[model samples]
Target: MSHWLPASPCTPPGCAVHAGPARRPVPAAALLLAGCALTLAGVLCAPLALSLTGGARRERLVRCWAHAVLRVFGVGVRITGPPAVRGGAAGGRAGTPGVLVVANHVSWLDIPLVAAVCPGRMLAKSDIRRWPVLGPLAALGGTLFVERERLRSLPATVRSLASALHGGARVVVFPEGSTWCGRGPGGRFRPAAFQAAIDAGAAVQPLRIRYLGGPPDHRAPAGAAAFVGDDPLAASLWRVVRAAGLTAEIRVLAPIPAGAVPGRRELARLAQSTVASDSANLPAASVHH
Candidate 1:
């Protein structure tokens, strides 16, 4: 593996444990079909939606589709946060500048979860542009692809992100650089993406994403939803389909003003620590281990 590609010690074998029993094959199969149909609908409609709409209309379209996708997979969503106000007095910076939405990398589901709330340009690894169905959808959504394996491409990527932010675009990024099982230790947030916020004078919106539901304890990670290590996308999809009552809870913490910290490293650390501390404070029964 390349040194630049972020990795986690959490592996498929170690994290496949589920919070609840699997759905019977018949029901799971039906859900799989419905999810596939919904996804295809999104791919076909996305271009037309983008061509005809802008601003809030486009956001609603994306958010509704993402919510439907999560529902089809039997994954519920619960969001808690201060509402984003104009000039971001409540959530972000004190200007009309764009907001940088950053979140923990957990599963492929994380993509839709983020979009369900903050619909905007996403910073994704270049390889996602080649995935079968998701690739087209992501492209249509204005994803900014990055060559994570190439150290030389870092500056260019940062510049592109800054340009987007400068244009008053809310850009979503997963700074872990890779996915991890939603349970154990997650990879630390990489500092590279934070540079764009610094350059654009944007507000940083840190989000904490956790997969909840299992036995009464509800402390275990939803292994079925994790897309980490060598787990294939198809396998992960099936696992999610078969899981019963899985929930993805999103917490949008207060946004840090642009230049709140001196450098990208400090900014990244601030965001990471914020997410970690929030997770630590959740009720022990609801917290993921």
Candidate 2:
């Protein structure tokens, strides 16, 4: 086991209160089991609720599940800017037509993190649709799956996304194409999906998700999938939950008018720059054990 001291009592310029080192009292095995059980139960229940209910009720159930998972894992999430707006007056009436959100790729938790806050449909990789438990759960949540290898299918995917936007359903896309762990930027943003926002004439909302602590060196532990690897889902999650409290700064950058940029590339660039700039300013969370 490792011993960590509270951040030095002396305050420094531009420094936030440092969190004391957390000790894992509960047995890792036990915590893992409990977390896995809760996650599986939640995943199983979500699909049934979606099938029986329509409209906001179904979404609320999913959001509840997301919150439940976070609570069970003892994770904390903090948002920095405005809350997300859903369709119509119920979602704070940002507008009825709905908005398209573009966010950076980080961990798999990004799904539930955004879902818990915004309550929007997600655009996920085709592989997720085939996962054991999560696949079905996400499908029930109305997540849009895209095949990255099939360039020909891109148009159809964009059209579906556009239609969803016009129908008053909020949609989220991670344009980084893949996930990465090192400091600085990871993958380049893929512009194809931005076409959906332009075609639908919807405002493009940019969001940035940054993890404060959790693995190897405390950086956003690789991507969520890798972090969860061969270990039981519950165990992997507990490792993160016990490692450190996670702080996510979700900034809703000013809405960019659809088609304001002549092409998807321009839209992607603008969104990427906005997210990168905002992430750079957040306080660094300790990764060293």
Candidate 3:
């Protein structure tokens, strides 16, 4: 929960576990903005192309751009688990057309991390849809917005997610409903999104995001990577940008088949338990650092 950024990078610089360098705030911020500009300019073509490209071309377009953004920002991603078997490297289908990637919400970086693996439609907070520039890009990519404050809108949002899955697009949802420090098992997995997977007969893939703490060679930091509470986006962004040596690990657990789980509530419980157990069993952050 502490927002202190590490001051040094671990030795043996090439190690993926090592967060390469100590970030210089001014340079990192400029770089972050540059990356955003590049991404926006590149993806701006998606809207026009979406209408003409009849295949996975549009997805690939946004995907390639996402990879570029993550690389420019110094975040690395690793995905582990069984393959989707049919769709692609990150897809897992249980006699269904698409995959419902359910991950624990941490910082906004989770988006590029996952996309660095493969492209997928994301379910974002309603406010994201109103952002100045990024909002339009997301709309072109078919992002679904959840009005967390409007209870009556839940059913419609779930239905939209189901439709996306049924249409063969990997749909990523952060069911925690908000961000947390991630030191403990994440907040409860709200069951609303589970219904989307169930209705679409899609396999549910549980993902865990662990923020790397400590200098690669020194002690792990006291708190885990999380962007929670009242931290402004600008502040969180600057913190990450300045922490050059900071890194996060993504673990993809076994996927749950469509029919294997009954009822939305039950599915939510199983998924939550699996993620919670994994987070609990993770070796203390200090040991790994």
Candidate 4:
């Protein structure tokens, strides 16, 4: 609701519950074990859903599992802009093709956060496709896997993404290549995703995700992985929710018309600049991904 960025690295005083070097309200080992259990369940159930039903029903199940994971972590989302389209209708375009929704990368949490809110297929790195439990669930979620180093695979990846969009499925992509804290200016967004959008002649919807307020004890420091490994998931998430209530602003800027932007590079720059500028004004704990 509020957009002010709070001062970072501030120690909250007089809060007896959180007052010590070890401020984790929940034990880290237990939280991780729960996460692992949830992930395993998701992986096991996904295939059954896919085999029994096709199309929208399966997508809905994926979304449900994603939300379940988020809930297990005690995260709540506050979305701005129109409700995400169900059954890949492109925000209500009927049989018309769906738009390509591109966002910035923030943390590992971005996967569930975006998946829970947006109903669509995600283009993720190949490594995520190979993760033990999470990878299988993501695959069953209809994620498109891409190889970052294999340029030869780029055309096929683009075509696959385009086909999904053309088939009335919104494709979500993190064009920033990897996650960042979103503390300063945003990271450089890769142009490949924009290229996919252009190839499909689909409009590009730029989404800026800002995670406002995190646990006082969690040290987000610098580096990308710190946000995930430096703090316990449940404790960190609860701290954020207690302070900011898992509040996030999903700003859907005006869609850029297909072919209006000269090239993928230019389009990428435009979208990156838009998100970076908007997110810069959000809370410090807030990150755009």
Candidate 5:
């Protein structure tokens, strides 16, 4: 592994604890099957959806699908913060900038949860392009793949991201570069993605996601949904479905406008601090800006 590639120390044994009994194995199995069916549906319909729908309509479609997926897996969602700004709103306005959505990485569930609020082009590792089923679906959804291992490719990746934002496209990124166990602030927000926002003069929207209701012994209940270290995707999925009362609470912090801070490092710090605010209490959601 490249030294630059973000790695988390969280492992299933250390971080993930048994949240509860399966309750109903048959229901859990059915839900997992439904989730799979939905994913396959996306793969089959996405190309046509891309061709026929406008950005706004498509965003609504994606959001609804994401919500459905979460519901199927019995994960409830609670969102606190200002309502998400719809994408492509500034399409004809030359100077108006786009929004860059950033959040803490926890589980595969994070993907749909983020989409449930702000639908956009996701920044994913280049390896996702080779994954079965998901790879083609991601491409159809306009995901931007980054070659993180090759430091030489950073500039080109930034340029692509900038171009997308300049064209008034909302982009979602996990600035931590890896998933943590969701105990405290998992990892620092890397400054590279912030550079794209600065170059495009875009706004940054930071969201903090926490998983509620896990094993009482665990410090962070969010670990129940965490997919970190060597945790297999199948194991993570099974855990999420079997766990009882797993609610994903998303807190949307105030958005940092274009040119709010002088540099990417400062911009990244400001956003991370905003997301990390009130970590101890996990206080009520309120819009920061």
Candidate 6:
């Protein structure tokens, strides 16, 4: 595993190479047009979403908005595995329930793309709830905001998240806590939210998102489309809109059951290992032992 510490954009199988931060040029016209379209689309949909009465209707509208924004942003999504399944890992007489979906975080775009594909409420940092116009829309669309900075609120947050999962909401969380400047895995997964799955007796779905297609300048040590460091949202969004045909490759790994009462640390390690392997950032033989 150490031999492949710096994987190179999956150039060969079983790589764990670091492609490094991306440098892309922002096309002025494309950025302006795409930005305006996305803003207008959000403005048009927010009130309509607010006007809608039912959760199902609102969720559908959000999904539609996700698709439209992808078009406006020139991003395409390709999902690679079966949706998270309930029930025993093998074919059996047991039944399946809602899942606690976990993934590695890379960009702000991760939000809408994940929402579009998963079609469920997502866990966002508390700061997002105060964003200008997007905050209310996200809350209305069923986003569950967690205050990670406060050490005291953790238990309640886990309980709240567990309750949501138990109630059959497919809750998505990025346990890496923050974004990085590589297509490879970032930091380790925090175990707190994994405990929610354990509490809810739900299966843990491990997924990974890899970016594809960027302008020539952006394709450096590897073709990484990361929104990391001090990049402002507008700058990151500008990079996205400027790159036509950019794709977010969402890969779903095999689900890990929360039964047997394995500790949350084990679950987090397993999920992170699975994501690294499936994402081609680590060799399959490199079990997180």
Clashes (N, CA, C under 3 Å) per candidate = 1, 2, 3, 2, 0, 7
Candidate 5 yields a Cα-based lDDT of 0.80
After best superposition, candidate 6 residue 159: deviation in angstroms? 1.0
Root-mean-square deviation of every model: 3.2, 9.4, 7.4, 7.9, 4.5, 7.7
Q: Please say which candidate is ahead in lDDT: 1 or 4.
A: 1
Candidate 6 TM-score, true structure as reference? 0.75
TM-score of each: 0.91, 0.75, 0.80, 0.73, 0.90, 0.75
| lDDT, candidates in the order shown | 0.81, 0.62, 0.66, 0.62, 0.80, 0.65
Report the lDDT tens digits of candidate 3 across residue range 31-148: 7797677667755777677788644565566667776776676655446665432233233343346888888876777777666555678898788787666678777777888777
Ranked by lDDT from best down, the candidates are 1, 5, 3, 6, 4, 2
Estimate, for each residue in 1-289, the C-alpha lDDT of model 5 and write its tens digit: 5423887777788777655545488888888888888888989999888799876787789989988889888888888988865434423354566789999988888988998988889999897788766788888888999888898888888898888888888899999998877776567898988999999888898998888774545433545788888788888888888877788878877888889999999999998988887365653232111
Count steric clashes of candidate 6: 7
What tens digits encode model 1's per-residue C-alpha lDDT throughout 1-289? 5524976766777775565787999999999889988988899988789789866677778889998899998888888998542223213343556778898888989999988877778999898899988899999888999888888998999999888887778889999988877664467888888999999888898888988777655545577787878888888888898998788888888888888999999999999988888877554332234
lDDT of 4 at 70: 61
Candidate 2 global CA lDDT score: 0.62
List where candidate 6 sits over 4 angstroms from the true fold: 1-61, 86-97, 214-224, 281-289
lDDT of 6 by residue, 1-289 (tens): 2211222232212222223333245453565577556756676567666676465565566667776666666666777888655332122233444678888877777777776666666788787788655676577657888766667777888998888777767788888777654444567788888888998888887888767664445532123346665555565565565555567777778888768448898999998988877756432222122
Query: Which residue pairs clash within candidate 5?
Result: none
Lowest summed lDDT across 10 adjacent residues in model 4 is found at: 1-10
Model 4 residue 261 CA deviation (Å) reads 2.1
Deviation in angstroms for 173 in model 3? 0.7
The whole-model C-alpha lDDT of candidate 1 against the native structure comes to 0.81
- Tell me the spans in candidate 5 whose CA falls farther than 4 Å from its real position: 1-4, 87-95, 214-220, 283-289
> lDDT tens digits, residues 74-140, model 2?
5566666775544542253544565788787655667777776677888887988887667877787
